[model samples]
Target: MSSYKSIPVTMIETDVSYHKPSQTFRESVTLEDSALEVMTDFTRVTAISINPCASLEQARERMVSSGVQMLFVTNQYHEVMGLITVNDLNGPKPMQAVSENGGKMEDLMVRDIMTPRLKLEALDYEDISHARVGDLLETFKRMGRQHALVVEKDTSTDKQIIRGVLSTTQLSKQLGYQVQSSHMAGNIAEMAQGG
Candidate 1:
C-alpha cells in the first residue's frame, strides 16, 4: 500500500427537529390547481405497500403507524395486487371474515379485504391532465371512492403503471373545504333508514 494520508472524518451535531419526519401535508385549501397538479405523485411521495398475506391487523397497524389511510397490497414481485383502505378495515368484510374464521382477526389477510385490481377503476394520465379539480371531485363522488388511481402505459414495457393517486381527504385539504357527493349521502341515508 502506498503511504497516502487519509482524510479525517468530522462529525457535526444538528438539532433534532432537522432530522424529524414531516407531518401530513396541509395543502392550500384552494381549487386553483388541476387534478393532475393536486394528485399525489408516487415518484415524489413514497407509497406504502404491504404483502397480500399480511394479517388485517398488521395492515391496519402499518397504516396507523405511517399516518396513511390506505396501503397497497403487493405480490412477491412487488407488483400491486390490490389495495386496502381504512374504509375496508372498518367495513363488514373483516367482520364477515372473523365470523367465518371462528372470530379471529389473524385469520384475515390483506388479500381477503383488499379491492382487487379487476374491480379497481383508473383514469388515464392524459384525461386527468386536462381535468380540473371539480371534475375529479365529481368523479370521486359518483364512484363513491375515497381514492382514485391514475394509470399510464410504459413506452418500453407496454404495461400499465400507477402514475398517481387522487385522495378525497387530500383534495379537501387542498381545496380548503369538504366536497360531498349527493349520491353518497343518499346511499348513507338509505342504509340508515334500512337499518
Candidate 2:
C-alpha cells in the first residue's frame, strides 16, 4: 500500500514598502487594490468596427476570415451600440438568409440578434493575458456578456475607437500569478519523500 498525503491551498501574501491599508475580507485580494491590473489602450485597440446595419451574412464572413469571435457594432454616430458573436450567427435562430425567407439582405441586419449596448467598454489589465482573464471575470459577474470590446476611448462620438475583441478563454490562461495547484503540491510531495 502507498502512503497518502494531504495538501493545503497556497495563498501568497507579500509586504509592500508603501502599503495601502489591507482589505478586511476573505476576497480582499480581489476587493482590495487588485493584485491583477487590466488595461485597454490605443495600442491594443487598432481595428475598425463593423456597421450595425450591415447584413448578418457579411458580418459572419468577416469574423470567420478574421478569426475573431466578436465584433463591435457601431451606429451612424459611430457610437458603440451592440455586440455580435460567431455563436450568435450560428445559433438555432441565427441570422436567417433573406432568400430562405423571401426577404433580402437589406431586410436582415445585425441589430436584431446583437446583445444590446449595456456595457460596451473593455476590461483593462496590466498583463494582457491576465488582464483579459480579469476582464472576463468582471464581465461574467455582470452577466449576459460573452465578449468585451477593447477600446482606447470612451467618448460617445469617438470615430477613432476601434479596439480589439476579448474572449474569456484566452484571458484565463495568461492572467494569474499564482502557482498551479498540481505543480506546487507535486513539488512538495517530492521534497517530503526526499527527506
Candidate 3:
C-alpha cells in the first residue's frame, strides 16, 4: 500500500481569470521573415471545423465564436471534405447558389458554398519550410487567394496531412500593414492602400 500526503491548498479568489489558449508570434515581422513564423501550425493549435451538412448560418456562428475566419468542413468520420470562409458566407456566392439551385438562403448548407477538397490547392510543407514570408505573399497574390494551406506527408501513412494555414489577415496584423486578398489587390502596395 502507498501512503500519500495532501498538499496545502488555497481557496479560489474572486476576479481571477483563467488563461486562454494563445499563439505567440514575433511582435513584428518583415516580408523577409520565415513563412513558418506566420503560419498557424495545426500541430500546436486545433483547427476549427464544421460539418458539411451544417447550415451556412451555423457555420458563420461557429467561425464568429471560434474567432476564426475559416473553418474546415469535416464529415462524421472527421475527414476533411471541404472548407468554408467568411467571404463565402458574406459574398455573392450564397445568393448565386440559391439562384442556381432554386433554394432559399436559409436552406443553404456549408457544403453548398464551400470549396471542395478536390478544388483546393496546398503548398508543400517542405517548400514552405524553405520559403520566406515574401514568397508566400507572392504565391497568395498569384493564386488570388486569401488563405493557403500547407500539407506534409505522413511518413507512416504516406498520406498528406494539413500541416498549417497562412492567412493574409494574420500577415497584415504581423506586418502592421493591411494585406488585401489577392482578389482585391493587384500588388502588395495596392493591397496596403486599398485597406
Q: Name the best candidate (by TM-score).
A: 3
Candidate 3's C-alpha runs over 4 A off are: 5-21, 183-195
Residues 12-77 of candidate 3: C-alpha lDDT, one tens digit per residue: 999998765667888778778898999999988889999988999999999999899999999988
TM-score of 2: 0.47
Candidate 2 or 1, higher TM-score: 1
**Residue 186 displacement in candidate 1 (angstroms):** 10
Q: In candidate 1, what are the lDDT values of residues 1-113, reduced to their tens digit?
A: 88999999988677533343333454563343577767877766778899998988899899998888989899988899899999899989898877776657767889888
- Range of the 10 consecutive residues with the lowest summed lDDT in candidate 2: 23-32
lDDT for 141 (candidate 3): 80
**How far does residue 2 in candidate 1 sit from its true spot (Å)?**
9.9
* lDDT on C-alpha atoms for all candidate structures: 0.78, 0.52, 0.88
Residues 1-195, model 2: lDDT tens digits? 769877888856786354433212222123123323332233533344589778888888888775667776888886778778787787743435443565654467787667778745554333344433333454544543554554444368654454445444333333423322223223423422432
Checking candidate 2 for backbone clashes, the offending pairs are: 37-125, 37-126, 38-124, 38-125, 39-124, 39-125, 130-175
Among all candidates shown, the one with the greatest lDDT: 3
**Model 3: colliding residue pairs:** none
Q: Model 1 — TM-score against the truth?
A: 0.78
Order the candidates by TM-score, highest first. 3, 1, 2
- RMSD of each candidate? 6.2, 21.0, 3.3
